[model samples]
Target: MTALHELTAEAAIRAIEAGETSSLELVDAALERVTSDPWHAFLAVDEDGARERARAIDANGERPPLAGIPVAIKDALSTRDLTTTAGSRILEGFRPVYTATCVERLERAGGIIVGKTNMDEFAMGSSTENSAYGPTRNPWALDRVPGGSSGGAAACVAARQVPLSLGSDTGGSIRQPAALCGCVGIKPTYGAVSRSGLIAFASSLDQVGPLARTVRDAALTLQAIVGRDPLDTTSLEWREPIELPAGERLDGLRVGIISELNGEGIEASVRGAVDSAAATVESLGGAVEQVSLPSVEHSLSTYYLIAPAECSANLARFDGIRYGRAAEGADSLLEHYERTRDEGFGSEVKRRIMLGTFALASGYYDAYYLRAQKVRTLVVEDFARAFERVDVLMSPTSPTTAFPLGERTDDPLSMYLSDVCTIPMSLAGLPALSIPCGFADGLPIGLQLAGPAYSENRLLGVAHALEQALALDQAPPEPA
Candidate 1:
């Protein structure tokens, strides 16, 4: 028999509704896996609260859709009384009095929060190694990284500690990690999910989404959290009902293979998988063709500029005096601020802050930040033009399969390049997702699917069609 902890979230929910399993049993099973974890995927586990919440759900006369499902939340989001460190010591032990609107929405829809997962400090790094709590190991290969800044959220799902997890995506944080971990992850159309209480990495770029073992499971979690939230003015009302279509027929669909994302640096194996996937799309009655978005060539350069600039500004508030913990024994006010930030933030967070400050400085703003913004406009135009010709786009989610931990920790440029393929869509505030297509060197490779703004319904429908046609079993292997 499969362990309760191994079941997909959708399966668990069905079991609970059928009285085949209870919420308490599922929560306890999930908690057991989390507590015995070797992957360091979680920052805090709310054992008592989770059990209490599960019991209440089990006792309810009319169970809700996700009544018994256990879901992990990334540590970056405010969780009311739950500790939300944002994977940094700067705000250690800080619990918000208010919950992020999306998290509240999840609870309201009957999903139980099992714990807060680990992440890159302030969501700055490309790998979980930057996490103040230590790196989250990939379940497929213990020595490899699960990708990051949402590494823990992806690892937790890939390792089967829980079937679904909430994670924030900023410059590929969610999709890259999900790809490396061999699970499904989504970066909702920006504003599709409110960012109200999510600690900012880059306010303009950050968006909350889900990582799950299956597409439908992810859709369910997404449906629960997405909608208009007055607290976030950028949020858009999702007036259309979210429906996950079933099966392998994508007849009359248009599929564009992004030439830039697919060419150059992408590993041969990853590229081959994508090519095979394109052929499969063709077989599904979809028109498959290569489409070039030339401005995407500058994606890495523009992302580094815009993301860091926004991060520098958004992170200014964590001065320790107002939020986070201040270091002891500082005589001068400036010294206090310096010591607090130096002691609280990780190297990557500080690195980006400095880079951003340099970019936005008095004399160089136009040369760097302004040019990047202009280039960003070009990128948006490129996508807009391409979408006019194609309904959806495809590529390898990451250029390479999961690399060993510490491989690029000291090489920031190499780490930054990891997001090259996923960042363009993020900059455009579009919806995209990564799903397991095939394996290379015994590790999972992700095939990314993206669509125009507010096109999640079409994107997901196409992804589901491919998911069914490919029929790859996404569950990660047990640790050797």
Candidate 2:
């Protein structure tokens, strides 16, 4: 018998349809893995609900695309029945009145929600340490930090606790974590996936996507989630579902390496890993060229400004007036709001909030926030121009591999640099994926491939070809 935990969603569906295994068997196996070992990946386990859903799917015989397959939803996305804490105390007992459209789409495609995975508080930090609950350790090496704010989501999939998981990428949150954890993450073009029920970090940049062990699984999950939604006006209008290339190769494809993304910022091992991945593509008859995006040098600064500005506005909704946690003993309404937010939000979140608030404040809005938005446009245009010359852009997902849990927590500027390579893509609203290409020391490294807007299918196709050539998705080292 096949180990139920090892089966991918597609494989599990095929097995269930063939009567080779029952949904209950798969669900029970997944529940066992999650319960016996405390991966610390999940914040809330919907064991009873998931089992009930599994039993229903088994009996009804109406299989969705991922019928009987278990998956984890990031805590950042709202679930009507599950607590939607974005790894913060502010929303500790919060449950959304309605489920996120992406979560609903997953259910429609026959995927079961196993649990709500943990994340950085309000999806602000690069490490899960910002999580009020506690940090999620890297599955490959428990001593290292799993990349965040999607760390729990990536760790869950990497550890095989869940074959598939969801993550929200604001600045490299999903892809970076996926790379570090030895999994695959797809951050679809901004607005490609609905952001309606996603707890906002930076409204314009935050995109919910899939984290899985294989490019196919990520593509399959993306196919289920990408489409226009009335709930989110900015959502992408992908009328036709994405159809991945069944067996694609890199022959004759043009791949661009962002020259700026390499060199000083990246570690030697990470640069080597990317160089190896590029060679793999070349061996498969793909043409690789060095491309330059001058505006990329300022992307980190621009992102910090734009993202925080938007975050300040988006987060203002949670002023203890109506939403989330409220201060218990405040005599005045103003005092209640101030105390609630000051007490509820973590230090990092508060820092960003203050920075963002200052940027958007009356005197500075034009000089800071508006100026950053203009810079954002230039960054997007640079990518657009580059795409005209190449089919896809490639880079190391992060400058370095997984670091020790508290390594850069004290130095905010150093932490910001981790997402430097990823922010440009988010700014441009391009689809990007990170697949395990190699490892540095004992930690995994991911090679990032990005395509133009609404090009998830093509991006995944390219990544799929690279995945086959590199075959770096091998068994990860046991946790320390």
Choose the strongest candidate by lDDT. 1
Residue range 147-167, candidate 1, lDDT tens digits = 999999999999999989999
- Model 2 is weakest, by summed lDDT over 10 consecutive residues, at 471-480
For model 1, the stretches where C-alpha displacement exceeds 4 angstroms are: none
The whole-model lDDT of each prediction reads 0.91, 0.89
Q: Candidate 2 at residue 179, lDDT?
A: 87
**lDDT tens per residue, model 2, 21-113:** 988889888888777545588898889999999999999988677888899999999999688989988888888899999999999998899
- Which is the leading candidate under TM-score? 1
All-Cα superposition RMSD per candidate: 1.0, 1.3
